[model samples]
Structure formats: C-alpha cells, structure tokens
Target: MSGGILEGDRNMGLIRAQLRRQRVLAGMNQDEFGKRTNYSASTVSAVETGTRAMDTPFAARADEVLETGGLFVSLLELARRDGQPRWFRPWLDAERAADQLRCYQPTLVPGLLQTEAYARAVIRCDDKLTDAQVEQRLAARMDRQSILNKDEPPQFVVVLDEIVIRRVDEAFHQALADQVHRLIELAERPNISIHIVPADIAIHVSLTGPFILAKTADGGWVGNLENQLGGIVVDKDDALATLLSRWETVRNEALSRRQSTELMKEVVKSWT
Candidate 1:
C-alpha cells in the first residue's frame, strides 16, 4: 500500500482506540455511549473498530461526554485536516459511503464524473490553488470516483445543463468533446443515469450553481452546495426535503437518459 494509505490507517486506529477507551473509562456500554452521543451503537462500533472515521461535531461531543479532557477530538482534528480545509473531510466521508448520489450541475461536470485532464484544467483555473496545490486537488477529485466502482456501488445520477457543455474554451474544446462522449458511455453503465436539460428549457431549479444530494444506507440524505466563498452541507430535515423536491422538478424538465445521451453526441459533433 502507498504511504498515504498506511498513514491514514494508522490514524484511524489511533482515533478508534482513543474513543473506545474513553467510553469504557466513563463506564459506558456501546448502546449507552451511542445514546449519549446521538449516534447509533453500530456507528459507534464502526468508529471504534477503525472501519469508519468520526466527524468534527461528533468528536467534540464525544470528548465532552466521555470526559477525556478533549484529547481525542483534538487529535482527530489534527489528523483529519492534515493540510487541507476541514470541510474536505466530511465531503469525502459522504462521497465514500453514500448508497446513491444525485447531482445537478449548472456550470460543469460533477467532480466525480470528470476526466482527470478536465479536472486538472478546472483546478488550475481556480485562483485559490497554486500549481502544486492543483495537482493535489486533482488527485483527490479523481479518488472520489471509487465509490462508483465498488462491488455494491452507489447509483450515480447526474443532470447537466446544456450550457455547461456549450461553454468550453476552444483550446480544450476537443478534449471536452471527448470528455462528454465518455460521460455518455458512462451513462450506459447499469448503475449510472445521466440527464441533460435543453438550452431552451423555460424552467430550472438552481439558476446560480450546482449541488449534490447523497442518500446514506440508514434512510438519511445530505445536500452539498458550493460557491466561490465556501460550501455548506445540509442535513437538516426541512432543507433536505426542499432540495429533493426542487431536484425532482428539474429532473422532470431534463431529457430521458437515452435522449440525453443522443443530445450529448450531437453536442460533441459541434465541438469539432
């Protein structure tokens, strides 16, 4: 295994042991600790066994209730962030474990579905990242696709606006054309679904940007919204419901999977 994988595994074990020890020191059983922490006993067990990692808020709550002087949470924060922004960890967690992923992209292809060349170009265009930083970001973005290749992979659904395909720069236009054709091929996979909204469509949900809705195994859903400033994850019941409803409407306006693929082919022809 690579050094990164080895280091990540080691950190996971450390966090698990810390959490388990604290729970036991508090004289708490799995169920009791889970009840106190607002997580399931199974989830707590997974974290403790190093099969899953804990999130920031959960780590803090665990520290407070377990009375471990906040040590575990502090250690978890240090290890999780490593060098990137804190938000990256939760996004990764959701991407890795989701049973289904639905995305609506008004501007570009969703990161998980992007080709490496396209992803690197997109990252390079972002002023926030240096050349080296863009390379790292590209690697992380590509790694996010593993969930789709797993044994029981997530059902991947993506809806793209025609504008996203139409706005490519001429320098990379041929590459983008190839990229879109590749996406059409991906849509043909049994586990994947793709939709494209017509440019002339009169109705759309999110006019300003893109978002993702991921469904977890426990009937829980989460929304990811990104912007120039930052991004937010919405797990609140009402917010998730609202996003889901809007997505349904948008999906209604998009072409069927077959028609979407045909449309993409035509769009690619125009690129040449």
Candidate 2:
C-alpha cells in the first residue's frame, strides 16, 4: 500500500486495539457489541480490521455498551494529537473521532475550515508562540483538515458569531477575506453546515467561550473547552448535557444555510 493509506491503516489499528481490548474485558462478542453501538456485525468487524474509521456517534454508543471508562472516546483525542502540536492534542483527538462535531465560535471560524492564510495570520498574532512555533502550529491546523475527508467523515455543524465577519484587522484583512471566501466554498459541501449567529441574538450558553461537542464510536459524548493556555475535556454526563442544550439554542438562533451563504458572499465582496 502507499504510505498515506498505510498510515491510515495503522491509525485505525490503534483504535481497533483500544476497542477490542475493552470489549473482551467486558466479555462481549462482535454481535453483542454491534447491537449496542447500532452497527452491524460486519461494520464492527471492519472497524476492528482497520477497513473503516469510527466516527463520534458510533464511538459514544460503543463506550456505553462496553461500559468502558471512556476508552474509545479518549483514543480519538490521542490519535488527533499524535505526532503534532502537543497542546492541541486533546481537542484534535476528539475532532478526528467525532461522529458529529458541533461547534460554537464567537470570535472566529472553527479551525477545521480555516484557510492556510487565515490560520497563519491567527497564529502570528499569538504573542505566546515563537515564529517557528507559529508556523509549526499552522501546519498542524492544516493537517487537521484531513479529518473532513476520511471515510465516513464526521458530520460538522458550526455556528459563527456574525461579529467574526466584521472583526478582521487591517493587517490581515486580505487574508481574512480569502478565508471567508474559502469558508463559503467549503460550506457548499454536503457534509458541512455553516450557520451565522447574528450579533443581535440574546445571550446564550456559549457566550463566554468556544466549545466542541463530539461523540465517540461507542456512544460516549465529550465536550471540549479551550483557551489561550490550555483546554479541558468534559466527560461528565451532566456537563455534556448542558453543553448540548446550549448548542441546541445557538443552532436555533443562527441563520439558515441559504441566508448564511448570502451573508458570507456579501462579506467577501466588501473585501474586493
């Protein structure tokens, strides 16, 4: 096999091992495990054999049915962070394994869809990272985009605060415009849904920060919170529920897809 395909197989192997070990410990067979995860026996076998990738929804179901202590869920985070930026591993891992990725960003576009130029500008502005570190971080961010192309890629749902469109600085205006245009193009894909949360909307749960809600292959749900220094992964059921409720409200408040695309086009035009 070619190098890229080989690497994918190896990565899937790690996840398969993680699941197989836990399932055996729990004393369950493929069919029993499949039933719990809402997958067919063949699908489970394929996942175990590295022929397929498990997304968050299935991961969460597997976790619940196997009664594992977030093993399947944690592996996804680990995989994302592997051989890349250390600080971002937790969130990245969750992103790769997510069956459904729901994001609420008040200040900018989510990382997955960010264009290279826009990502570079954002990284450069970070006073904390050295120049080389910024470049490295940018590369890592770009690499994360591959998750959107994996077999059975996770469903991505993102909400952008309208202010993000208006907040570009003079220094990065051109790059930001390119980024917005890139976003509009990417949003046209079937797997991605982009929503704009109007600036005028009433306050909601995610106002204080950005967060991601991801499900594991075993039916486990995890909520991720990030800041300038570090991030926390929330696994407690109550916390996940609260985050989900907040996300639902935000989703409700955001503009529809058609409206968002039209708004995006208008924003991009202003830069030209």
Candidate 3:
C-alpha cells in the first residue's frame, strides 16, 4: 500500500487502542460503552478492533461517558489529521481564520454548503472506506459547517457550474432538492452569496478545476487547489495573483444572485 494509506491505518490503530483502554478505565464493557454512545455492542467492538473508524460524534459522546475530558475527541482529530495530505493541512488551518472565502466548483457542491445526507452520499463515493469510516468522515464534514455559524462568520461566496445542480441522481433527488433550498436560504445571509455559471458559458478560467481563495483575518491571502488525490496550497505571490485574476474572471461569468436563486427554484421544481 501507499505510504499515505499505511500512515492512516497506523493512526486508526492507535485511536482504537486508546478508545479501548479508556473504556476499560471507565469500567465499562462493550455493551455498556455502546449504550453511552448510542451504538450497538457489535459496532463498539468493530471500532475497538479497528474494523470501523470512530466518528466525531462517537468521540464526543465517548469522552463524556468515560469522563476523559476530551481525550477521545483529541484522538479523533489526530486520526483525521493523519489521514489528510500534508499539503492540505495549511488550507484547513487558514479556512478557520479566513475573513472572506471565494470558491468555484465545477463538479460537486462545496462541502460547507452540503446537507448531511448529501455529504454522506459524497463521502460514500470512496469505496475504500468502510461504512463506519464513511460515517466518521461525514460527521467531520458536517462539523466544518459550524464555521458558517460563527458570530462574525466569514464572508463566503461560491460560483458553481450549472451542471452541479442538473446532475442529480434519482436516489438523491429529494436530498438534492433540499440542498438547493439550503443554498437559497444561505444566500439570504448577509455574509453569503451563491452564483451559478450557465452551462452554455462560452469560456471561463474555472474550467481548469476547483479552487478556493481565502483572505485571512490578518489580511494574508491563501489559495487552494483541490483534486482527487489531495490538495495544494498556492502561496507564492505570482501564483496567488494568477488565481485571483482567474477568480474574478469566473465570478464575472456567473449569474447574479437573483438570477441564480430563480434558477435554483426551477431546478428544485424539476426534482419533484
């Protein structure tokens, strides 16, 4: 296996050992621990055996039940951190402190805007993950949305290719409809804006791939390119400038907020 995959497995093994030790320290059997975490005994056993990945919710609940004072939560974060590519870590850090975020997606809906079911569907596309691992990742993704709820949330703007809305599968039709409505609701927030790039757009810089530009609280700018394998943080001044220019060009090609909302409404109706 690849080094990255091996590292992830090692981290998960450590997490499982820690979880099992903590449960023992609490004088709880698998069934008892399962009761606290709202999971079945078999599920708890699976996590302890490293056959299932432990999710954020499970960590929080376990920490509370075992009175570990967030130890499990920390371990869960560690496992997640280990699983991510090194290059993507900086972008995750920058996102938390960003004063403004601008993103352009040509394929899937941006993670921050996805609903729970939608997020689960996206994560499940990774066939390597066990059902438990998928749930773990899904919970983590959902937790990231808390950033949007901050009192002084970042000003966020997303420009999505029109195909993103039109490419719904039948199984997720209702969920996707809810997601469109969610976009509309989020757009009503003063700090958020959502735009759509018409499918017939003659040309655009965003055709290259999905990218995010974040303006940090201290005024520094960070650019990130996300791909299937991993992510890259573009920090060089020359590269940042080029990405910013492309962002402006793509933003210009996107429909206005009102028009995008109208189009979203139309799409939602078709899903019915």
Candidate 4:
C-alpha cells in the first residue's frame, strides 16, 4: 500500500485506541457509553474498532460524557483531515486557528451556518456520495460549527447572496426556516455578522465566486475558494489581495446587519 494509506490507517488506529481508553477510564462499558451518547452498543463498538468512522455529533457527545476536554473532537478533526484532499487541510487549519473569518457565499447557505436538515438536503444533491459518506461529511460540517461556541471565538462576517434565501425547495420549508432562525441567532452574537446581497445587484466582485479570508493570530491572512469539485487554499500575496478586494466589494453590496436581519425574518415568514 502507499504511504498515504498507511498513514491513514495509523491515524484511525490511534482514534480507536483513544476512544476505548477514554471509555474505560470513565468506567463505562460499551453499552453504558452508548446509552450516554445516544448510540447503539453495536454502533459504538463499530467506531471503537475502526469498522465505522467517527462522526462529529458522536465525538461531541463522547467528549461531554468522557470529560476529555475536547480530545475526541480533536481526534475527529484529525480523522477528517486524513480523509480530505491534501489541498484542503491547510484551509481547514486556518479556519480552526483564525482570529477572524470573512466569507461570501453566492450559492447555497454557507456550510458553517447550515442547519442539520438543510445540510443533509444539500449533501444529498451529490449523486456520487453514498449514504455513509454523506453522514460522515454532515457530521464533520456540524462539528466545525463548534468553533463559534468557543470562549474566544473568531470574529465572523458572512455575506450571502439574496438568491440563496429564496432558492429553497418546498420540501425544505421547515428546515430552511430553522436555518434562517439559526442565522438570526448567530448574528446576534457580538462577534458574528451576517449580510445579504440583494438579488437585483447587477454588478459585484463576488460574481467571480465564493471565497473566505481568514486572519490568523500571527497577523497573516489565508484565503479559500470552494466549488463543486473541491477547495483551494490561497496564500500567495497576489491571490490573497484579490480575494480581500472581492470580499470588500461584496460586503459593500450587501445590506447592513439590521437590514439583513429584517430581510431574513421576512424570508422566514414566507417559508410556511
């Protein structure tokens, strides 16, 4: 086997060992641990033995029950990093460590802000992914949201195209409503802001694409461009500058925070 495969197996083994050890230290048998985490004993066993991959929800619940102080969450991230394309890992690292995040989404709702149902619906659109793969991806996406709950969460500013709110399907009405409510709740946090760019805006730099610019603790910036195929981490000075320029232009086209909130409320009302 190739080195990459070998490394992945090793990392997975570490996760399995860590999870079993933590459970034992907590003095809980597999059945007891499963009960605490709201998973079946067989499912817990599968994860412990590496027959199944750990999902974000399971990791979070395990961390809480085991009092591991986020250890399981860290392991879950490492496992996810191992599975992702190499080009995406640096962006993931930047996202976890950044002091500030600026994002523009012209398509669907941003992954960080999506509700579970909305996320499931979005992931289901990909015909290539199997049910298990979809579940794993959903768990990882949900886990990333934990960053917002951290004591010193990053300052987040997100700009969404107005069409994103209006594009929801009738089947997702309730889920979309919950998602909009979630956006409203998150926007209320002093460190987070959400803006909506009017659909009528005839011109904007974000027309180029959706991107995120993260400001790291060491006063450096990293950018990411994401699309259907995959994601690219941007670190080159010229590229970063362009992304920042586009972000500013898009933010200028978006409504103010209060206006965006009111608009979102109006949209939520229409979901019924």
Each prediction's TM-score versus the true structure: 0.69, 0.67, 0.88, 0.83
**In candidate 2, what are the lDDT values of residues 53-152, reduced to their tens digit?**
5655667788788876677766654543453434445666777788888888999878888998888887777675545445445655776788899988
Candidate 1 Cα lDDT to native: 0.77
Candidate 4 local lDDT, 2-21, one digit each (tens): 23234555776788898999
TM-score of 2: 0.67
**Residue-by-residue lDDT tens digits, candidate 3, 1-272:** 13544566678788888888888988999999898889999999988886666777788898889888998888777666666657766887888889899999999899999988888888888898767667656766776787899999999999999999888777978878888889989999999999999989967777989999999977889999987777789889999999999999999999999999999999888766
- TM-score, cand. 4: 0.83
Q: List the residue pairs that clash in candidate 4.
A: none
Strongest candidate by TM-score: 3
Clashes of 1: 0
The collision pairs in model 3 are: none
How far out, in Å, is residue 96 in model 1? 1.0
Clashing pairs in 1: none
Error of 3 at 121 (Å): 3.5
- What 10-residue stretch in candidate 2 is worst by lDDT? 1-10
lDDT of 4 at 113: 88
